[model samples]
Target chain A: MNSQLAAYATSNLWLIIIGMGIITFLIRLSMIVLLGNVKISDTVMRGLRYVPPAVLSAIIFPEMLQPAPHGVLDISLGNARLVAGLVAIATALISKNMFITIGIGIVTMWIWPFIIG
Target chain B: MEHSQSSPRREFWAGVKSEIPIAIGVFPFGLIFGSLGVLGGTPPLIVFAMSSIVFAGSAQFIGVAMINAVAPIFSIWTTTFFVNVRHVLYSATMGPKSQHLSLGWRVLLSYLLTDEAFVVTAWHYDNDNPEDLTHKHWFWLGAGLTLWVQWQISTAVGVVFGTQLPESWGLDFTLALTFIGMVFVTLKGKPMWGATLSAGAVAVAANGLPNKLGLMLAALTGIVVGMLLEGQGAQDE
Candidate 1:
C-alpha cells in the first residue's frame, strides 16, 4: 500500500490537499458564522428557495432522457423517470407529502426500468 | 414521561426522526457515492473521513469524481468550491437562530451544516419563536452524523464488493426521485420557475463542457435569472 501510494504521489500532494481543505473550511466557516443565523432579505431568501429544485432537476432530467454518444431519445414510452417524476409532482401537489412523493417516484422509476429492459 | 429516563437518547432519536424523511430517499445516493468512491480507489478510511469531516453530499461526490491518476491542486479546489456554494445559502438561512449561541457552538453548527437540516431547522424557526431555537443543533448533529455513518458503511460495501454488483441498470434515478421530492416541496413562485428553467436549459446545453464546469455556470446563471424574475414578479404583484 505504501509503495502504491508513493507511485501515485508527486511533490507536495499533501500541501495541496491541506491548502484546499483550509480554503474549504474557511468558506464554509465564514458562511455558517456570518450568514447562517442572519435574517436574509426576502428577495434573497426567495431566490435561495429555488436553488435546490433547479439544481436537482437540471442534474436529473438530462441524465435520464439523453441517449448517450448516439444522441437519441431513450424512450418513446415507459421512461420510468419521466413518468414517475410527473407522478411524484402530482402526488406532491395533491397530498403535500414527502414520503409518498419519493416512495411513489422511486418505486415507479425502479420498476419501469426492469419492465422496459 | 418515559422520555425523562433517557433524555439524551430520546433527543438523539428525535433528531433521527426529523431527518428520516430525507434519509429514506438519501440512502441510495449514499450507496452510489460509496460505490463510486471505492471504485475510484479512495481508501475506505479516506472515503469515511471525507464523508464524516466534509459531511457534504455534493462535495464528497465531487471529491471522488476528481480522484484521478493526477488531479491538480487547483482542480480539486475548484470542484469542491462549486459543489459547496449551496452552503452559502444554507448559512444565510441559519443566521438568526445562532445569534444567541456561542462562537464554539457556531463553529460546530458550521461543521454539521447540511441543506436539509438548514431547511427543516429554519422552517421550525420561521414558524416558531426564535427564543425557542434550543436543541435544534442536536437534531442537526444527529441527522448529519447518521448520514455520515451511513455513507461510509455503504461505501465500504461498494469498495469491498464493487466487482460483484451487476449492471447498474439506471438505478441512479432513485437519486433523481429524492431530488424530485425536494424540488416539489420548494418549487413555487415565478422567479423560482424562471431560474430553474434557465438553469436546466444551461445544464443541458452546456453538457459538452469539460468536467461539467457547466454546473457552476448554470448555478450562477440561475442565481441571476432568479433575481431578475423576482424583480419582474415584484412588479406584477
Candidate 2:
C-alpha cells in the first residue's frame, strides 16, 4: 500500500484534485450556462427526463449487487446488501418516504448478519 | 394575487428548512468519505480540500479510491467527469426556469448544484407558485448552502476522528440507502421504470469495466430505452 502511495506523489494528487474540480464544475455548468438561451429539442428533453432515474439506478445497482468495492457479484439471499436494498425498495414503494426508506434499510442491514448466522 | 408576496429571505430559509432531512442523510456519507480517504493513505488536508473543491459526493469517493490505487490522473479526471455528467441534465432541466436570472446567479447556482440540492430545488420549482418565481433562486441557494455547510463540517469531524469509529458500524451503507431512496422517489411511469431497470441491469453487467465507464454506459443505455418506450407509448396513444 505504501508503494502505491509512493507512486501517487503529493504534486500529482493536487493536480488530480484540481483537474477533477474543474471537470466536475464544468459538467454541472454545461447546460445552465451554455444552453440557457437555446431551445432544447423534444428528443433531448425527453432524454433529460430519464436522466435522474437512469443515472441513479446506474450508481445504486452495483453497490447493492457487489459485496465490496470490486467484489464478486452477489445476488443471492446471503448477500446482506442485496437484502437491505430490497427492503429499502419495498419501503420506498409502500411509504414513499425517503427517511423511512433509509432508516428501515439501515436497520435491516445491521440486523441481517445475525439473522443469517 | 391576494396573498402577501414572500421575500427572498423567507424563501431562502424555506429552502434551507426543506433540505434539512436530506442533508441529515448526506452528513454521514461526508464523514465516511473523509475517514476513508485519510485511512486509505491520503493526506488529511487533501481529503478536506476534495470536499470543498469537488463538492460532489460520489465523484469524490471514487477519486479517493482511485488515488489509493494510484490511478493515472487522466483516468481520474475522466471517471470524475462521467460520474458527474448527470449534472448536465439537471442544469438543462433547470435552464428554462432560471434563464431570466443574471449570469452571476447562474454561475453560482451551477456551482452549488448537487444531486441532493437538485432534488430539493427541482421539487420547489415544480410546485412553485407564480408569485414565488422571483425568489425561487434564493430557495435554491439556501438548500445548496445548507448541504454545503453540513458536508464540510461532517468531513472535518471524520478526518479528525473517523479512524476511531468501528467499521462494523457500517456507516457507509447509508450512501447506498440514500441513493436507493432517491431512485425510488424519482421513479414514475412506464418509461421511468424502463430507464431504471435497464440502467440497473447494465450497470451490474458492466461493473468490471475500468474507470467506471460502466456507469456512464449504463446510464446512456437506460436513457435511450426510456425514450424509446415513451415514444412507443405516444404512438399507441
Candidate 3:
C-alpha cells in the first residue's frame, strides 16, 4: 500500500464515516422530528415511492455490468454476476420471495465460473 | 377490525417475527460487508465498528470500496450521503406514525431506521387498524433491535473468520442479488418500472464515472422520470 494513501485513509477515515453516520441519522430524523402529522405533498409522496426501485436498480446495474478491477463493460453471458443477477431477478419476480432469490443467485454465481471456464 | 388490548411485549415480539425475513436476508449482507471491508484494506476494528455505527449496508460497502481506491475523503462522505438519501423518504413516510412518540423514541427509531426496518414497519403501520396502533412503537423497537443484533453477530463473524473463509464462496455477489430482489419487490406500477429501467440504463452508461456519482445521477433521473409519468397519469384520470 502507498504510504501517503495509507496515512490519508487512517487520518480521514474515521471523520468521514462518523460524519456520514451523523448525516444519515439526521436524514432519518428529518421528517419524524420536524414534521408533525402533516401529510406529504402528492408529488413528493409519489417520488418517494419510487426511491427503492430507482436506488436499488442504480446500485445493482453497475455492479453487475462493470467488471471488477475497473475493467470495461461486460454484458454477455460471460459476466457471471450479471447472469446470476438476472436469475435472481426472475426468481424474485416470480416468487416474490427474498430467500429463494438470494439462495439461487449465490448458487448460480458459485457454479458459473466452472461452466464459463 | 377490533382493536385488541395488546401489551408492548406482544407487539415487540410481533415486530421481531415480522422482521425475521428481512433479518435473514441481511445476515449475509453484513457478513459480506465486514469481510469485504477487511479485504479492501480497512482495519478490521474499524470495519467491525462500522457494522454497529454506520449500520447502513450499501453505504458501508461503498465507503470501504472508496477507501480501497484511495478516493478523496470529501468524495467518500458525499457519496455515502447520496446513498442514504432514501432514508429521508423513509423518515417522511414514517413521520405520521412517529408523531405519537416522544422525542427520545423518535430519535431512537430514526437511528435504527434502515431499508429492511422501514419496509417492515411501514407494512405494519399501513395494514394494521388505526385503533390497534397503541403499542406499535414497541413493534418497531422489536424489529429494529432484532436486525441490530443480527448485524452485529454476522459482522463479528465475518471480521473474525472472514479470511479463513474461502474466496470461492462468492459471498460478495449476494449484496447485488439482495438489491435485485428489492428492486423486483418494489416494482409495482408502470411508473416504478419506468424508474427502475431508466435508473439501470443510466447507471450502466455512467459506470465509468469516479466517486460513484453515477449512482446518485441515475437515482435522481429515475425519480424525476417516474414522478413525471405519475403526474401525467393523474391528469388523465
iRMSD, all candidates: 3.6, 2.2, 2.8
Off by over 4 Å in 1: A1-23, A35-46, A65-80, A113-117, B1-15, B128-136, B186-195, B207-213, B220-237
- Pairs of colliding residues, candidate 3: none
Q: All models, DockQ values?
A: 0.41, 0.65, 0.59
Answer with 1 or 3, whichever has the higher TM-score: 3
- List, residue by residue over B80-196, the lDDT tens digit for candidate 3: 787787677688777866787999999999988987777667667756764466788998899998888998899988887777766656666676787677668535777878899
Candidate 1 per-residue lDDT, tens place, B1-237, comes to 332343445555666676677776777666776777766776665665566556677777777666644466577878777667656656655654566677887777676666555545554444434345555566556766665566666666666666565444444565666666766665677777777778767876776676556665676677788888878777987
Which residue pairs in candidate 1 have backbone atoms (N, alpha carbon, C) closer than 3 angstroms, thus clashing? Answer: A35-B91, A36-B91, A36-B94, A36-B95, A37-B94, A37-B95, A37-B96, A38-B95, A38-B96, B34-B155
- Candidate order by TM-score, decreasing, is 2, 3, 1
Clashes of 2: 0
How far out, in Å, is residue B123 in model 2? 3.4
Backbone collisions counted per model: 10, 0, 0
* Candidate that scores best on lDDT: 2
Provide the lDDT at A86 for model 2.
93
Q: What would the per-residue lDDT of candidate 2 be over residues B1-237, giving only the tens digit for each residue?
A: 222667789889988998887788778899999999999988999999999899999899999999988888998998898778778778887777788899899889888999888877876776567435777899999999999999999999999997887887778878778878877965678998999999999999999897678887998899999999998999999
